[model samples]
Target: MSKIKVGVIGCGSIAKHRHLPEYANNNNVEIIAVCDIVKERVSEIAKEYQAIAYTDYEELLANPEVDAVSVCTPNYLHAPISIAALQAGKHVLCEKPMATSIKDAEQMIEAAKESNKKLMIAHNQRFVPSHQKARQLIEKGEVGKIYSFRTAFGHGGPEGWSADGVNSWFFKKEQAYIGALGDLGVHKTDLLRFILGEEFTDVGAFVETSSKENADVDDTAVCVLKTESGIIGTLAASWSYVSKEDNSTIIYGENAILRLEDDPVNSLVVQYKNGEVVKYELGGIQTNDAGGQTNTQVIDQFVSALIENTEPVVNGEEGYKSLKVVLAALQSSETRQITSL
Candidate 1:
């Protein structure tokens, strides 16, 4: 494929801020079409990119020119659209929290396998400058024999970001299925698995809707997770942090303690038991208030993988594994007992 032709489904915040702009800017990609249920919004985006507009996603998928698609629809539509795209002989790059349930995730993966197309998940945290640096240090045994860790992701709420504002599908249970646990916590779940290079085996949590009004989904979640190697950690996700966004992680090891996103000035910091401190002044993490643009390498990698005919880092298996931890946490919250995977 000389140039990968791309189609974007769902003209929401994620598409407007990340997918469309990134695809238009990628020299190796051509924006062939844009789709959304909203006619006005989709037409505007299509005109901006000088491409075709589609109100139904099926029409976009049927086009022979589109070689790939970005699944940026509501949480519930992620799996179905991804599966359909794959079956249509197009590669897929899906958003986080791949699906509402494990069965749907499995079906999506199978569809990709049957069609022999790439299926990548948008787990952008793995591409953050600070996050990449931290992973290298951990892999090099800089944090020897990890004991415990804590990671959290919190923000004001989706009302200020979503295209629909307070009436966005994010606030609806039927559309979103789960709340903070899926939106915010799933990112941390995927990030932790990437940085630690381990799978969570047990999950115990408290997921609740503590803030906001007139919505049924949860607003906050606190989870206790145990990895396969017996590494214990706590993960908290929330939409009630009235303050600024919080995306931070701390890891304690026998030789040192590593911190990430905990400091705005020094994004990645390491302190050894010998009383030595080192800091890396990487740029700020991408946030919603800053237009939610993605410069974290996800788009570039997705394009590269498609052009080179290779599997991306956050493929279906990796995405499914990360999503399992989040789903387990939700189950734990309901059963009031630890869930094991």
Candidate 2:
């Protein structure tokens, strides 16, 4: 099997902790080039990965040896870089919140279509073992029909995560577009859609920058979402989880309630109205070393999709749809009115 020669744009924390490591670990992928505006970081990452270093992403994109690229740049740069990579005959594995706006997301999908390239969004939450099992159970009717759900993804601010630390682009409105909403909310947006097999039709949101200092973007947000099938739910994303991360969800159905990542020990639990309870000890979610968890399988899946000539589970259109929900929530917050998707 020919290895997929991969180039990574953005030598930031996410690229380092997730993309870079995961790609290197994948046997079918070879790190061909590393790009970042920060020359020092790019050079170091290139040396570590045994790949060439390029400060200009365009230069890296021009390399014919690169078969695919990971767009791990800021939210603002995702659309342009991914579209360009696709046009360059390279499959794209873009970090989530596909783009800052619905228009940009649509353009990205169109670009992939025109290029006949695979565009996979790195919404890693759906690959969580417990979340995967929960989806399977729900589809098998273990939860009957889902009536509602509440999902949240929260952690200490990006200061603790981004490579630039407290001064990261994540705190800048122009660069991040939307803070926790894009950084974390989009994961839940994608995860809920994947787990319930439903699309959100309406959103009412309350977005705020309540906790973080010296940050112009939102630190906390709560959105009420209704699916096409009348399943209503609350989606919350926050950067104010100083105590501990709260990445969990609860789904209420006609016969049972599924608690995903709600408990420390058991990753998933189902409570039945008939006095039966099932606990699942699925493995942990992907996180930084502080969380003592493994990285996500996103890079391997991207490589497989490209190699097999198959659409990734989270393809360009799927990403665009998930991003639409996030964009709708932001619009709802701005207009103080319910937004229809």
Error of 2 at 37 (Å): 0.4
273: Cα error in model 2, Å: 0.8
lDDT (C-alpha, whole model) for all candidates: 0.92, 0.91
TM per candidate: 0.98, 0.98
Worst 10-residue stretch by lDDT in candidate 1? 289-298
- Which window of ten consecutive residues has the lowest lDDT sum in model 2? 286-295
**Candidate 1 residue-wise lDDT at 295:** 74
Off by over 4 Å in 2: 289-293
lDDT of 2 by residue, 1-341 (tens): 88899999999988988888888888898999999999899989999999999999899999999999999999999999998999999999999888998889999999999999999999999999999998998899878888999999898888887889998999999899899989999999999999999888999999999999878999999999999999999999999988778999999999999999899889999999898999999877765536433868888788889888999989988898888988898899999999999
Root-mean-square deviation (CA) per prediction: 0.9, 1.1
Model 1: CA > 4 A from native = none
